[model samples]
Target: MNPTPTYRDVATVGIGGPVGSGKTSLLSELVPRLREEGLEVGVIANDILTQEDANRLRERFAGVVPEDLVAGVETGACPHTGIREDPSMNLQQIDAFLAEYPGLDLVLVESGGDNLAATFNPELADYWLYVISVAEGDDIPRKRGPGVVDCDLLVINKTDLAPYVGADLEVMTRDAREVRDGPFVLTNCKAIDGIEAVHEHIVEGVLFA
Candidate 1:
């Protein structure tokens, strides 16, 4: 028999980007800051076949967010399917989170590393963020992938590595502005720089205006 479940009055945010683009690092930074602002947050990390990302987040969040609130979803297929084409697995994990942590105000669902075409199923996310790294190349924004053009917010991470990688932030910024109607922010997630702006977007776009 299915167990009776707890329903959550929560806003879900989906985070997606190419591999090594700092999606997890951004979450690491965002979760604590959100908690500091008095929001109860849960997290789910989706991976193609491993729980590595989820384990990392569990350790990073530690006592700030209950361990049970962080979970791993193994998609067993392309990362996008679990977040976009179909999202039952993520939805179920969310329900479980809500059941365990009553009054949970937000859930950040991190999609496994995927290309720019990936996006969240609207049913699974109230707000979504797409992350890209300066290390990927200065031309990423110019590519104008759906994820970059469609997400509520776009994050250009690893600003500190820009020059080292020969990525021109100014050009990327210009291209991003040309391709999207929404806002984009530059970040060095490892240093916690620019995370406050990302948090502000979440607050204004989903939590409270």
Candidate 2:
């Protein structure tokens, strides 16, 4: 008989970035789009001590995703500990999801706000995205942190705030290209700008690829 399938049987995507980088906002936009395409998507939000992000997502996806499929993992430590260093907790959650939803097409894991050094364990995410805010300054990409340079896609969010924050989008664009061999998208989550490109990358990177 064929062995029972596990989380590995489904596609997993990781979204990591610094505090207030708009990871949840991106998820709010992406999940509905994926559901509209007839894809069953699960979501997990990892926070140090609170379920704030997860709870917010559950509310946002109330009609789109089943309440049970959206979970929160409190790592009790740095966000990276749950997503990168020791992903056992996250893995177990994914396993639980697969048990109830074997046909699940994708799982999006959002790490608690972290520094630019955060990254997902290969065993945890099939594809990963690193989100940064232009408000954080255009120098973020130039720093070449692992999260920025190594993620499959680098998302520069809050572009609409660039002018007010004195962040130069052009410099960020140039620096991101210089640091990452992969593609990056500039997004304004509030207005849903450039979200389509982000969705396309995920569809191609993990869903269809």
Candidate 3:
């Protein structure tokens, strides 16, 4: 006789960024750390016509998370559409997770690789992080895209690549501060540097809030 749970019934965090911005790498690192905290988590990766990111996450989270909890939603349109304009697909996936695992603590929704304009619909994500890579350019933050400006948190990833790519971390830091009122973290996902800060932000922004 219980009511069916909705996406809002569970905490959801959406991760969105340009292609090759290290969204997947960040997820791979964060999920295990969350598991270590003893929280049950689910993940949904949105793609245009493939489950590539979802499959990769499943493989990475194999021992830490249940395979059934990681799912891929093929939007068959622009990446932003599924998470922004129309989020029915993502909402449905979250509902499915709650049905199967009522105790699920969190669900991380990773948007398909997109441009700087991509953002998640509030109805779909209680909190969202927008990721960008130094490899892309030091000018990205100064460009002031909505993804960077509106997300609950802005993640500047690939700091290790900054030196090699001629991206000035100092410039990125200054611009990020100027553009977003929210907090931003500099991360090197490959080495696991700064991942903890990202996790803490999520924990505070959603789970513990």
Candidate 4:
């Protein structure tokens, strides 16, 4: 079995993937599931320029997720620094959340959804997930990026769009398994399919509950 995620004083999970791979959409689905499970979740969106994803989440989750719980980190450089190279700002945001909300159970850091090369620093996240979409094509796994091989979990989303995009879902999953030799999951956020498995994966793998 894979090693348990490194324990942090505060639980931090990084959600990362390629652009438009449905990372944010997974968050939109997960935040509510976590809340329903009574987890007080805090979110930090790492954006390349504007706080578009952060703002979108804020407006989308308005009443469901607290306003102050969401924050944006303007990733001046490539999307990696905010979560990887120097995670100082992200760590600061996490500590600030713990200070402001003592009982915060989990913090989800949504990376800007960069290329397959991006990953999270352990200093920034106890556990990390790499999201890819079926729409990106099956060869993504064959590319064997660190994001696919090293993340705590591999999430292949947008299954509903697989046919429209002409992506081979089965081959994608098989390649992921060959690359990861570990846990991988598929989902369609639009249809709310496989979301519970995602939630359970985080709860069992990251939160250890």
> Per-residue CA lDDT of candidate 4, range 81-104, in tens?
898898877887877787788888
User: All candidates' TM-scores?
Assistant: 0.95, 0.97, 0.97, 0.93
Error of 4 at 65 (Å): 1.7
- What is the C-alpha lDDT profile of model 3 across 30-49, one tens digit per residue? 99889999999999999999
Kindly indicate the candidate among 1 and 3 with the higher lDDT. 3
| Ranking of candidates on TM-score, top first | 2, 3, 1, 4
Candidate 3 minimal-lDDT segment of 10 residues: 1-10
Q: Better model by lDDT, 2 or 3?
A: 2
Q: Report the candidate with higher TM-score, 1 versus 3.
A: 3
Off by over 4 Å in 3: 1-5
Clashes of each: 0, 0, 0, 0
Candidate 1 lDDT over residue span 1-209, tens digit each: 76543333678999999999999989988898899989899999999999999999999998898999999999999999999998989989989887777689999999999999999998899899999999999999989899999999999999999889998989999999999999999999778889999999999999874
lDDT of each: 0.92, 0.95, 0.94, 0.88
Q: In the order shown, what is each candidate's alpha-carbon RMSD?
A: 2.1, 2.1, 2.0, 4.7
Q: Which ten residues in a row have the lowest lDDT in candidate 2?
A: 1-10
Per-residue alpha-carbon lDDT of candidate 2 for residues 1-209, written as tens digits (9 for 90 to 100): 85543878889999999999999999999999999999999999999999999999999999889999999999999899999999989988999999999999999999999998999999999999999999898899999999999999999999999989999999999999999899999999899999999999999999889
Greater lDDT among 1 and 4 belongs to 1
Query: By descending lDDT, how would the candidates be arranged?
Result: 2, 3, 1, 4
